[model samples]
Target: MAKTLNPSFSALYSYRIGSYYFHSNNRLFKFLGSRMRMKLIFKMNCDISFLAKIGDRLRLPHPLGVVIGAGVEIGNNVIIFQNVTLGSDGKKGKEKSYPKVGDNVIIYADSIILGNVKIGDNSVVGAKTFVTIDVPPNSLVIGNPCKIIIKN
Candidate 1:
């Protein structure tokens, strides 16, 4: 959205605004976002649900492969890189609960924050990390099985 001139900030702006409307249970807003959602998804290579409660200034520097679930709750000032998946397990029909991300967290590229997990505030999740458990606040986590390397 930011990289183009023809379809510029207006599209991205509309998407964010539309997302707000969709989150507020307004059909018009849903329609607006639905119209631009796929476009932006294709543009940025990401899928962020309108139902996902995102706080102020959620930054996506690189948006590719980001799959945020409907039930996910993101905190303020969170910086997420590419390939971050905040979602649930493969359970159909039943109500699924996504992750609850804390404030000031930095989730690096290719990190999977999945399935009812809570990423604590001020935490930093390293690249290619696969997280399936709750993370403590002010911690630095890395690795596939996931290791808590440092806790500030």
Candidate 2:
């Protein structure tokens, strides 16, 4: 499939390009990249910032309404579906308060992960789940308040 044909791919590429340019020391590239990122925010409704530390092969099945906060850290091969929000809580301190997603994790549609929570590797977050605590590795999380099930 052509990269241009896939909206998911387009979103990722746009993010990659914008991130690269935004991080550049050159002022002109930073300005252009910031412009592109703004366009992405308005057009695609994806509010991922260049400050986010996302690992390799991050997949967004449906990119719309996905908001990844500036300090969120996502590990490799993570899959995030539409309407998912990974953001920070109202708690203010010197520490980083955003959620950290582990490798090979699948965050289903409409899930909200907030605060200084750590999602363990190879876990699955069910659709519409709200998570505010640490999830263990190889677990399945589901429900509004979030229930953690240890997978064998």
Candidate 3:
């Protein structure tokens, strides 16, 4: 009783001749699917690096011009707009710090979320706002210092 290989895996692993073309085709299809899914997911996770960790529930209106730094932790149902930067504050020895965002967070266009700050759940950061500090849950923040504009 010998174990049999799966057809797709066997086809992918067996021959080197047709396998190249076959795998290429498969990879092309996979890439296309990932791209389309990325677009859709971006509508929901704007930052690719962030999506890499959180698994694409975060939507980005436009992924372009978005830079999500390493060590950033994003929660579920997050929506980010275009031209957003989520990164470290680059303060004295703060280059390694990353922002931790909570669930249902909505960050608008051109907003910068930086430092070792934690944005609470259901919070919204308005466009062009710069946040360098922590935000409470269910708060709407705007402006340079990111004062809480409203609480939900």
Candidate 4:
């Protein structure tokens, strides 16, 4: 595939392959996948967890500095730019939580979504946005404090 050969898409390819192998029934394959994930973390600076569930047509335009934490679920047709983080609120508790991103979402660069937030479908999160609350569907979210605009 062209994605496999494209240098710009190397991080996405590695993540996809590692995710596939991590889900395999074979333990050896899981180990290898974990190693590959580690390589992706250390070398590529993209910390995408194998535990995270991602849907079809996920696009990472600039994969560097992207951190997707464990238990994060992303829906189909999501585009995430560079330095975007979807993770927990850094709370210490028995129950761990992460953000859930819906379908056809565009997360711009330097955006951070923390806690058990839910980003609804067909939403656009603007650059440098910080989201701690749930985002409604068909909305445009922007700014550091986050202002929501319902799309027509």
Candidate 5:
């Protein structure tokens, strides 16, 4: 079977357009002329930062303060709340791993998901929860050492 193309490629394309516009202009005033354009630039920066793994269905309530690490494979329909970090654990390079987030997952606010963990599809992670293990599909995890409170 042929490999599927990324759906967010169009968004990345538009981001590149903004990047080109920002770099092409010589005058500073003309560049930052309008407030809408400035906001567009900021959004473009966030989009381009994690251009590799961000899926088409990825929705950010507040794009700012959201950091997505490189090589992280995010599935479609994933909603990430603000102040969320999805990246490596930085364990002295003991093992190189990236979080593989499954489709239709909802990650709540201020949650820290570390290590090379696998979060299954349709799972909901509560706010302020710290997940370090593989969560089964359709499960709900909450608290410091995230546990399976509900199984679907």
Candidate 6:
């Protein structure tokens, strides 16, 4: 796993560096720490902290205004759209509080999943929704207060 910083490669390669720097100690870390790696991600108009626990196949379709908290844990096959905020529930500073999204979840644009809520597997969070509570599995959550639309 010797990844050299290729000068030819642009900032679009941030995901590889962002995912790698967190869980391992390589030449990448020696060259660039978490802050620097996250900086690259920020350049892509997303603020996903390297401290956040992100699973495999994490796709950010429109990465702009996507603010993922340091405490957030995103599961596999998660497709997050633009202006999505996976962060704390207004608990002020220095708090380990955020959402834990499950696998195969499709979070649409401008949605905000806050607090320590656990979104179940195969769930779909609708656009511009404000979620602060735990959602059941295979459900579709929508609206400001979040209406649970159960899916089979």
TM for every model, in the order presented, reads: 0.84, 0.95, 0.64, 0.92, 0.68, 0.80
Best by lDDT: 2
Backbone clash pairs in model 2 (N, Cα, C under 3 Å; residues 3+ apart or in different chains), count: 0
Query: What is the C-alpha local distance difference test score of each model?
Result: 0.81, 0.93, 0.67, 0.92, 0.69, 0.80
Task: Give, for candidate 4, the lowest lDDT window spanning 10 residues.
Answer: 2-11
lDDT of 5: 0.69
Give the per-residue lDDT of model 1 (tens digit) for 13-78. Answer: 545776866666677777776866776677756777777888877877766677888899999999
lDDT of 5 by residue, 1-152 (tens): 22223323333444444445555555653353332244434653343332336565677655445566766888999988767788788888487567889999999988888878999999999999998999899999999978787673
In candidate 2, where is summed lDDT lowest over 10 consecutive residues?
Answer: 88-97
Candidate 2 or 5, higher TM-score?
Answer: 2
Clashing pairs in 4: none
Candidate 6, poorest ten consecutive residues by summed lDDT: 1-10
Q: Count backbone clashes in candidate 5.
A: 0
Tens-digit lDDT track of model 3 for 37-102: 454335433334422244236665455566777578888888877788888777784447889999
For candidate 4, the per-residue lDDT at 114 reads 96
Could you give candidate 6's per-residue lDDT for residues 31-123 as a string of tens digits?
565655656555666677767888888877667788888889999998988889998887667566889999999999999998989999999
Flag the better candidate by lDDT, 1 or 4.
4
Better of 4 and 5 by TM-score: 4
lDDT of 4 by residue, 105-130 (tens): 99999999999999999999999999
**Candidate 4: misplaced stretches above 4 Å?**
1-8
Can you tell me which runs of candidate 3 are displaced by over 4 Å?
1-47, 50-52, 92-95
| Strongest candidate by TM-score | 2
